[model samples]
Target: MFEEWSDRRTLRVFDPPRPVWVDMAATGMAGGFTPANTVPLRVRTSGARLEQRMQGWQHAWLQVSDGRWVAVVSVRLSSANEQSHASIPLTVAAGAIRPAESVTKDEP
Candidate 1:
């Protein structure tokens, strides 16, 4: 569901279901080129902006806003509106949920 790469796009960092090795350097490192490399790479866990998109021999990488590179599969491109909505907590009165009986199979 990722759109084309663009600067100033707010992105959220998330840990994948499985471990994904990420590169710490933005350039001159071939560690991200191969997932089976003996070199020990770090996992992604920081939220940052989209700096650049890099194509690796085996995978695609995204240069984070902080100059660190991470697997594209590890982060999700977030829109400014989504970021703003995420900050506002949902109150119980917001109707995020309802009584179990209120949700019927036919209605849903």
Candidate 2:
């Protein structure tokens, strides 16, 4: 799944261990700022894939840009099952600096 906010982009993917539904939610926090709304992520899979007797995992990537700042969040799920759920908490710094090397530039 992909999401685009005012100045951010987010991507999420799921790999389930069984043919069940999984839900995911995330919230953002900053000083003197309460958390925003919770976003629900839904995942579905086929039974054949679940019965294959193999390990499963899920991946999620989130990127946030607030004009002067950029942030990223990555999530990994292991052995996900029917009752699997993930809650992620995000913190935004008011005056943090990110190294230049950490920013990805367009490939030549």
Candidate 3:
């Protein structure tokens, strides 16, 4: 069973058949007025994966190594699919993960 906490806007997480692990990250954005272009030209998606060791979500312990990985972004398909790509770098220290800094931004 599951429960919804509207006040927190978060769902309760329960144990699944297997352990939940996060290895990659992705994002998407879509807007604009395009009557043509047939498909993409208005939407975009980007994703990237990390290498080396980063684990232990219990306390969020991550031991990442310095490396670089390729990241790719693609627009959702309609009639014509458009894609853009890029490479991202990972700067990690060999130790427990540190709390990420918070950023303030307006909603899209």
Candidate 4:
């Protein structure tokens, strides 16, 4: 799925073990971002709301200026029944994503 945000673009990708409702090999990605257009990302969803998680694919961070934006995508394994599905969105706290800075010892 795709989200056309005013600033940045958001696209949800399901790296499922296998395919089902969505054709693993087929989706009209006309003028849109595809897996080939992917970039490295960090994800978390420990305390995310169901409502936010249910948006398939969307941008959960706007004012946030640190971590990779959250992408809420649905997931289902080929072995499991269709009823067994979930919305896994990358959850994160505000301003929590940043590179760790090392501290150097000086004359204290």
Candidate 5:
């Protein structure tokens, strides 16, 4: 789980098996845009993994699966009266274990 915030620039990253969330608030925009908005996009990983990248102003949500992993990376830019927040959720399996290897050496 990770959280980050900034007045002008902000970046955040989320790790799987944990809850990842972010929030932002902007006041007073130079441009005539009131109550700014954010755009969000997501990318899934191969075989039980999730990945996402965010830019500008955006937020995201991710679902977790059993024996799976998830990750999210995001960035934000804010102006007066325009704030953006982003969040991602990752779920993983609980009962999946990897097998261990045994090594043996023979000496004369």
Candidate 6:
């Protein structure tokens, strides 16, 4: 949960109905990047891969994709039983995370 990259898995953001703040560079900042400086991104209910985890000095962060970091309290991983299906690569840009490939291949 802290100080490691969780296995590549799916997760959904439930709280903060709006898109969550991201530390584009994975920097452990106090308030994260401001809206004016960067576009906030939302995780789809369908979910996306869990990338990396960071135990910051004051906050916990999860990298949902390359260069996309969200606070731990904002999102929840798809339950182990519910995430039996595969998660394709995500296309992140301008506050959205879309599946890059149509096919969903199980992780090896």
- TM per candidate comes to 0.19, 0.17, 0.17, 0.19, 0.17, 0.17
Off by over 4 Å in 1: 7-59, 74-108
Q: Write the per-residue lDDT of candidate 3 for residues 1-108, one digit (tens) a residue.
A: 223333322222223211112132222122334354564434422322222222212211122233422211111122223244332222222232322223111110
| Candidate 5 off by > 4 Å | 1-65, 79-108
What's the CA error at residue 47 for candidate 6, in Å?
25
Candidate 5 lDDT score at position 90 = 21
33 Cα displacement, candidate 2 (Å): 16
Better of 2 and 4 by lDDT: 4
lDDT (tens digit, per residue) of candidate 6 on 27-76: 32223333533532332324343434311111233456565664442223
For candidate 3, the C-alpha RMSD (Å) to the true structure equals 15.6
Residue 57, candidate 5: C-alpha displacement in angstroms: 13
In model 6, residue pairs whose N, Cα or C atoms come closer than 3 Å (at least 3 residues apart or on different chains), thus clashing, are none
Backbone clash pairs for candidate 3 read none
Model 2 lDDT tens row, 3-93 = 4433323433333211111222212221232233332233232111122121112233334443333223322233234455332322223
* Tens-digit per-residue lDDT, 1-108, candidate 1: 235555524433332222222231342222235343653333222222232331111123445567654443222333323341111111111111212322222110
Best by lDDT: 6
C-alpha lDDT values of all predictions:
0.28, 0.26, 0.25, 0.28, 0.24, 0.32
Candidate 3 structure, TM-score to reference: 0.17
Q: TM-score of the candidate numbered 6?
A: 0.17
Sequence-dependent TM-score of model 1: 0.19
